[model samples]
Target: MMRSAALCMALCLAMSMAACQPGPAAPPQSAPTSSVAGPPADSAGGATSPAVTSPEPPAPAAPPALSAEAQAQLDQELVAAAKANNVPLVSELIGRGGNVNAKDAIQDSAFLYAGAEGFNEVLRLTLAAGADVASTNRYGGTALIPASEHGHVETVQILIAAGVPVNHVNNLGWTAMQEAILLNSGGPRQQEVVRLLLAAGADPGIRDPEGRTALQNAERLGFAEIAALLRGHG
Candidate 1:
């Protein structure tokens, strides 16, 4: 009976010891870690760590089609300034990309208007702005023709000195020389013009549409001094 009791006690003690012992050392704990696959998320809701980016493309260029209304407005500004003989305004307009050789509705360019109106300063401006010396009016006359007919001696001198084709005949078959004689009397002013034109290599023999020479036109207009000048050339 004692042996039976002792065996029962021993079995109970072994069971208690096994229960208190740690089970299989609980499989060693592992530390938390990160991967190198990609950037980590930002806590502040901003860009991620090792942030990635790309270059932005350049802006587009301006279009080339000119609007009709804009073109008309530019033309109006240029014409008004030129016709008003506002040298500073005209220069300003030209500097702002205004067409120096732009023709008016009547086909008269700024240089033509300036020369015809005896606006010598404006004439100089337009010329320096690359105005074509041969730009014509509706009547097919150059700047020289009207200036000659109006006896603008200084304007004529300027035109000739600027390398205008002194012998150029218009569609009307009129040379500046003929206009200087037939359109106006070859008086002292016209006489000075003739001298200037002749000195610049004007062809006195060039005829008008009526086939009249400058000397003949001078004679018909009773411009004795002009006729004598032409005779000396002949």
Candidate 2:
């Protein structure tokens, strides 16, 4: 009975020692996580920001519109300026929407008058402003005819280069070549005009209203140099 009592006391002492020992320490706390996302990775595994672009520029503004009366007045002014060899006024009027092919009461357009009168500055302006090359004058002749007749060599060259038909027959049924021979004195300038005309494919055989060829007219007018040029071309 003494031995049994002693064993029970020893077991109760062991249970009391285990309960007195402290429990394991609590687990270590982790840091707080961020809410924001990081930059995205590229195919090469590099971080890339969003692409930036510039705004597009605005288009050019169009010219103002004009009424019929206002436009007609501008065209008339342009024609007068061109006829008077007023280069600055012609350019300004053209910029203001003046028609280069608009005709005056006498059927004289800025282009026609400038070309016929050898006004090269005005002619160039009118040409650039869209002069009608095939348009005729009061005489129903191209600017080249009068230019050739007057021995305006440079004017003739400019007109021809602008695509004036060299063999075009005017109302008088005379080509520029015939007019150069029949009207001019066949001086050095006239000879050069004839040369330019022939080079530009003016037909020497095209007859006038009187049914006379340019070469025949030149021979009759005693234009030896021009006749020689015609014969050489033939």
Candidate 3:
């Protein structure tokens, strides 16, 4: 009986060792394992699945540098501020070595900026500071062309009084007188301008490259009084 008991104990020991030995893991059951949990089950045994979330990409950033030409244009705006006689700004730019007569890429100088805006105080300061009155723009127009065309009669008068060429032509081949009449600029001052030109010995009959005369322009624009004046009519 004792021998029988010993054999039974040995069998129990062998069974225990066999249980500890790893067997081929049962192919993971179709059921989800602990590492990957499926969605929670609903009350009706239906499961709510987690949505697939994609990470959003970041937005693009601004450019890091301005081109050389852009830098030049910025410099031009500074020069314009000087021409406008923003005295503090002018002093700043000039202090920073800005050119007093710097022409834009299109050949428009700082004086043109002042004249175009009819800033008389700035105009006086610019000219007194040595801004060139005779500088032409890209269109070969002196500052007088714009001054007359835009009805800045006082500015025109100022330029005229300063000896600006009243007969100066632009790229379109129109002189200041023709521009005034064609654009109906110069109001009462226009008549005065005509008188001033005539008195200055400006031939009222001078024709454009298109063979049109200033008198013809005056007539076409229905300024009968002006036409009559030009024609020496009663």
Best by lDDT: 2
The weakest ten consecutive residues by lDDT in model 1 span 32-41
lDDT of 3 by residue, 78-141 (tens): 5678455686676555444444456777675666766665666556655665666777777788
The candidate scoring highest on TM-score is 2
* Candidate 3 wrongly placed segments (more than 4 Å): 1-75, 82-100, 232-234
Residue 111 of model 2: what lDDT? 97
- Put down candidate 2 lDDT per residue, 1-234, tens digits, no spaces: 999999999999999999999999999999988898778899999999988898899986655899999989988998889888999999888888899999999999999999899999999988998898989998889999999999998999899999988888888898888889998899999999999998898888989888889888888989999999999998
lDDT of 1 by residue, 1-234 (tens): 999999999999999999997777567679867665555557986658674688888876544445777666665677678789898998877766666677777886778889888999889988998989877888888888888888999999888888777777777788888888887766799998898888888999888888888888888878999999999988
lDDT of 2 at 118: 94
RMSD of 3: 16.9
TM-score of each: 0.68, 0.76, 0.57
Please say which candidate is ahead in lDDT: 1 or 3: 1
| Model 2 alpha-carbon drift over 4 Å, by segment | 1-60
Q: Name the 10 consecutive residues with the lowest summed lDDT in model 2.
A: 55-64
RMSD of each: 11.4, 5.4, 16.9
